[model samples]
Target chain A: MLILQKISQNKTLAATINQIHYVVIIGEGLVGGALRDYLINTFNYKFFYNVKTPWTDKTLIEAHFNELKTFIFEKIFNSQKTELAAPSFLQLSFVWSAGKAGFAASFTDIDEEEKDFHSFLNLLTQIDQERPAFVKMDLHFTSSAGGLFEGQSSVQEDSQPHPLRPYGILKLRQEQKITEWSQNKSYFHGVIYRLSTVYGRIRRGQRMGLISIMLQNGLHKKITPITGDLYTLRDYVHSMDIARMITSGMISSHKPHKSPSNNLQVLFGLSQKPTSIFEIKAIIEFHLKHKIYIQFNHTPGNARDITFGKIQPPFEVQARDIRSGIKDVLTDWYGAHT
Target chain B: MEGTLSVSTITPVYCGAQYLEELIKQLERVRQEWQSKNYPIQIVESIFVVDAAKDDSLAILKTISNNKAYPWIKVIELSKNFGQHPATMCGVLYSTGDWLITLDEDLQHHPREFIELFKAFAASSYDVVYAKPKDSVHQSLFRDWGSRGYKKLIAKITKNPFVIDFNSFRLIRGSIARAAASVCGHETYFDVAICWFTNKITTQKLSLEDQRYINTGTSSYNLFSLLSHARRLIVSSQTKILRLGAWIGIASILLSVALGLHFLYLKIYDPEAIPVRGWTSLYLTLLFMGGLTSTLLSIIIEYLSSISLQNQGKPLFFMVDRSSDALIQKFLNHEPIDH
Candidate 1:
């Protein structure tokens, strides 16, 4: 009877501490790192990252879940331990798994591709199932706007994705699963950020982008072969801008979840306008103050190599100028080399 | 001819944003004049290779290219500032016309005089024609004299009289220009590469003005830039200069041998005729050593020169398109040449 009464009091205390929100980030990579730093520095939200492993050890996965559960419980009950007050809302941001290789792999690797898909699905399932039961859990997922709408010139939140590659197909499937799961639950609120081509300083073991490759070649004074033609255009956004948009969308009072109309909202996260490969090369060369020798290969054309239309982000955000962004990246690279 | 021949004027721009507008205006005027006069040639495109200028030259060029009135204007922004010659080669590679005329972006090479060069090519049946200024060039006296002296020296050394006629403002057949540019390496002087392909070169006299020099009282070529040009010119030429070293070594050795024999003959005849006791041996030793050193140095120089030429993509043999001459003649006469 005494233990039952204590449980009843604990439930009342948990409801009182529900004013504070906790954000759990799944992947800690280039975009994830930026988003994690942004959420902590801007909103002072408590941050937790999922343990990264190959998922071969069931004991390791269970231990990780137990550790996360204990951390969340302590944050809710022991408010005096941390610098910030107890959490009211819990926001979970997922930004992991999948890259260019998933798209570039041939049909002969179907089995491997399927394995990758299942691994991602299983990850999401585990997260959804094992989330803290004491608090209201909000989810934020990042999907690729460029990959999903591969050959399409212009894409919007409502545009039906006609994915051409396996990577895009897998991304679309993940989006569908998240959307379906987010619906039919009043307590759940989710935001899907469809990101454009993100360019920034990639962390170690992170997926490399064109900008990073060009900058690295320029710094080393090496020749960089262009796989695409001069006219291949891409919409580039700084990773920090995406992080800021995600955080701002979460904190705003008129968020998608707060709306009486819909529980799930999709937003595009694009910073800079569309730029071509030729223009990007010129900008990088200008910043480096050296000539980057280029040899054009005779590779067959890719379907996604078409020019992109103007990008319209969901909200207004300060976009960094590409020239200065290149300068900053080159400067950082020079620092590292030196 | 299936259609009238088209011409492209390629200008490599570097810190010439201030003069770009005026340059384009003059080029447009020349194009309009050619069309109105019923000339068989049309200025199809005016390609400007912007060599990553420090100024706002690229933005100005973008504005001009975007304007509907200047549809023929095509701007190619290079990855970085490759000097004037490489930039010109880049423009040449991008050109698509029957004839390509390269000029400076400073408006010193007037577009109005292109007709004279075309006429010169028609009359002489030459593959390339250079526009030589008839009047005193509007450069400072020092630069003008330095340019003249340098050209004369290069002509004398390389034994190629065509070096004297080389100028920035020139007309070349598009096919040959692209071919030469393709084989041009970082050290290859563009005009010297053209010379390697053909000796059929001529010059047309035109009155010219340098408005930029007249207004600013300073030319872009400094002492260092002049030295760099001289180095490229000497490197691109055949190793005739090194051959001169070998000839000198041989001549000295022959002369010294004759002198030594004469001294020995005199010693045998009469010891009283010797000027000093040990002077003959000392002089003989010095002559032999000097001649030997010169010979060895010349051989080393020849070997190094061959290596450099190979690195510069000097071909053992190249085929010239004889059919282009017939096309040029047809374009000149405004009638198709019969097969």
Candidate 2:
């Protein structure tokens, strides 16, 4: 068991009295990986159990979830005994940032994704049923802003979910499941983060973002075919910013007066600025210091301009500027390739 | 159906809850129509700026926008009722398209007419295209006559030839539209500001009927609003009407001088023709004083008009790129646009 204490040099982390006993991350994809990194480095949490299962295989996935439930039960039981020996506050967080489908996913793919999501929800029910009385549970579910509000522009905070594809429908369904789960538990604090188009460093075997793909194609001197036209707009937020927001949200929720509640708080994770594909291409080209060829395929149904209105959420962090972020990603890519 | 040209349609909603759904449905049809015909143009987004309606228009707009089918519907809510021009300006600034078409929320301007507007725009080197009503819009003869007569009279008075063509149903180049919107102050009339940017404006004849007025026998613009609009338009424009005052004053001074000369001739050459002892002198003095006052008032108005123009943030010059006109031309010519 790794007992991690706050470093004295890091004043911000040291100042907070948050004692998160356990954090179970359900996914290890781009967003989940970034979040885990933040928790270990910036957030300074050592106890973590990463839940990974083949989302497509129902039997194996269910068995894996059962094991996860047993793991959590034993850990909490031990932590409770330790709390009696030394009086302290304990917090348990379940971060669900997993998805196996893209916006252009087929119906079959979405169905499998939906099944995996249901299994995860079942596990949550099991944990909620047997959880200790004193342990506060904070559930953070990652929802897609692009999927929920596809082809929409100037999406307000109160705007309804208008999912275009099956992938979007699945995301909405997952959010509904989490909302339903949190309804009965008074100790359950739920946060649904509707993330806009997320761009970041691409990990191997994971889905690549437009910016990352553009840089990759540019490096290989290959022409990238865009399914959307130059004028298509989207709100892109970096994944690290999403991590910061989620951590901040958890910290804010644990304050004395701001205790756990059954009612789920919805927050839009967005940059609040709509960037056009043309502008993005220019930015990439400027950073790459070369003109990259892009052919606009613009598949008729795939081209939808999704933009978000200005929303200042309570847990928002100062978002990294798109230009500098792109530059950093490019530099990282260049370093790795070289 | 994808094309190089993109268009954004802006509608300012105020007490237009009844017609909004039908308006959106009609726009959808036009969107589908364009896509089916491969019209080399796409309706990128439809922006509805709700200017704080007294009714449940905003709620209905939200409901309509959230339907998943109309994902391109963007709603902008003002803090309070900022009137139509400001709301329209807000929509224009939010728009991200190659061209912008502004229409009423009352379903008066049918979305199908956009084809005609687009055709006219593509055929000419115009920056703005206004849909000219083929017949009566209000159905009431008096109202129609009044609307036309007011526009013509304003056009003559202000010497703004485009005033007669200033219909709410208009297609403006996106760059020009946004640029015009950016410089607009609180009281700046939107159409007047547009005129200051580019004079390449044309009109397309279309059959338009104000369905709301026809059904309800009332218009969004009552007599008070129209008058207010006229006053704003006059104020926003560099009106030649002010110069008319100076011209009239000069004519008066000249007339008074000629009359004074005539009176002097009568006094000197023909003494018997004089009706009274000092009548000629008194009349000449009054005429001269009246002319001087008129001239002084005109000069004062001239100074005020200059100040008003400056206050309105009238740009010294505006730069626009008409390079996309070639694409529209190709589209109009039925040539393949992708190449």
Q: How many residue pairs clash in each candidate?
A: 8, 0
True contacts kept of 2: 0.00
- Candidate 2 structure quality by residue, lDDT tens digits, B6-66: 7889999999888889889999999988878767678868999999898889999999887
* True lDDT of residue B103, candidate 2: 95
Each candidate's DockQ: 0.02, 0.04
User: Given candidate 1, what's the lDDT at residue B163?
Assistant: 86
Pairs with backbone N, CA or C atoms under 3 Å apart (clashes), candidate 2: none
True contacts kept of each: 0.00, 0.00
Model 1 chain A: worst 10 consecutive residues (lDDT sum): A1-10
* Alpha-carbon lDDT of model 1: 0.68
DockQ of 2: 0.04
Each candidate's interface RMSD, rounded to one decimal? 11.7, 7.8
Query: Which runs in model 2 stand beyond 4 Å of their true positions?
Result: A1-338, B1-3, B255-275
What TM-score would you give candidate 1 relative to the actual structure?
0.51
Which residue runs of candidate 1 sit more than 4 Å off their true CA positions? A1-338, B33-38, B139-141, B322-324, B327-339
